[model samples]
Target: MEHQSENKDMNHEFLPMTSVANNTGDQVAPGVFVLTTKIVNVYFIQCSEDPSTYYLVDAGMPKSGDMICEWAEKWFNHPPKAILLTHGHFDHVGAVNDLAEKWQVPVFAHHEEIPYLNGQKDYPKPDPSVNGGLVTKLSPMFPNHGIDLGSRIQPLPEDGTVPGLAGWKWIHTPGHTPGHVSFFRENDRVLIAGDAFITVKQESLYQVMTQKQELNGPPKYFTTDWKLAEKSVQTLAALEPSVAATGHGIPMNGSKLKEGLPHLAQNFNELAVPDHGKYVD
Candidate 1:
């Protein structure tokens, strides 16, 4: 799918004022909504029984709290029931505490991600030395703030089932982070792929800025284990997701996702894996 090139100013207004939906949300799938922030995408899943009860998936960067809350109010008319974290990455969970506290909702994360979320363990510092593109070069500047959400944090259900959203399952798609999980709706074959697979080659700022759509593996410099990462891609490929909305880039579906996914899963090393990087060791 081709997208027209649009320039975003320093104010970060990508869409026009009239086109911007203070409450107009993008329907990623049947009940899933996507609200793209400055850096990351925050998903809002509405509960089937009670529309007011919704789940917020992956809080964006710290600067995104107000934007997120505004969107939430416009869409759901109230705070989210819970905040489900894909992982404890600096960007993904940056505003978790802020949103959770304001809404007084509990945060759910995989057990394996506890250390990083609880501030006990730090991810390997990003290496700007990795040769990729502008995003990789500026990696060292990405904020790595750890907020204390322990008071409201809870472990994800061991069964991989997300409460309130029946018929959906969470898969352990580690390598981006130990506890990173992607939501899958088997019946509709819609996948809420986290960073396990992105539509754009995230290492390249040009691709991200342009919103180029292509199936690619996780960001290399931030990804820790190539072997595990490959397996995770293969695992998702086997599911044969009919539609996917990922952490970066626009939503993708149809023959492109069907055909390109296996190729990416098979040749991930050549397409996205860096030869040498900080996380590789």
Candidate 2:
């Protein structure tokens, strides 16, 4: 089936923002690979029990379809069985339509995220005035429009089981967006934290460009609900993931993940939530 958005004119344009980590790939865990295209990260997870089967965690930046395909082929020699979305932000789902169409794979997301993915609703605009740096100021240019994935998008299973993935479950970690979710494997404590929390000061153009390893909140300009964001941080921190690959920055683990995550969780308001912003109460 062809992928058609409700808004035929809806489009994602490439942003000028980038980082040193762009185009780099790393294996954060056994069979779990993280690739950064432009800025956001997309994960490739090969099932240990079945070498031939694997899944794409998130689609990367706009016009990144070919890069994602190349990376997948380089590692698995085939397309993913399904595309999993943490949220429907422009950067996260940029290559989704192209990849899904090419591979003929099903796309899954949290039920609440369906609207954003299926063209039923647009995300709230990024708050450019959030107390942040250059990236925050440039937020006005970011796309808040939703794409139309039509019938290709399905709600993630209510049982938390990830489709085609064994030993992994999705956690409803909203606040950045209504249906934002993080994938976690209880046995390994390996987490794909998505934008629930990140490893860079996303609002600062300089830090984002340098790939500084700082555990911070979701991109502030696009984050609408601080209260829910705080809760989401706590939820993931409680997981105590051994290694975390976020939407931005390189993978983090060890004492950093252990100490930093909970610290961010406890001090979310001061550390994550901007003191002043259009979305702040």
The candidate maximizing lDDT is: 2
Q: What is the C-alpha lDDT of each candidate?
A: 0.77, 0.86
Off by over 4 Å in 1: 1-25
Estimate, for each residue in 1-281, the C-alpha lDDT of model 1 and write its tens digit: 01112322222212211122232346656667777776467788767676567799899766788888887877767888899888888778878888888889989888888778777777877777655888988887876545567778888899989977778789999988888889888887878888989887788877776666788888766787778889999999999987777887676776778899999998988886777776665
TM-score of each: 0.89, 0.92
Error of 1 at 201 (Å): 1.5
Residue 4, candidate 1: alpha-carbon lDDT? 17
Give the worst 10-residue stretch by lDDT in candidate 2: 1-10
- Model 2, span 50-122: residue lDDT tens: 8678899889889999999988877778888999999999999999999999999999999999999998899
lDDT of 2 at 256: 74
**Segments of candidate 2 deviating more than 4 angstroms:** 1-22
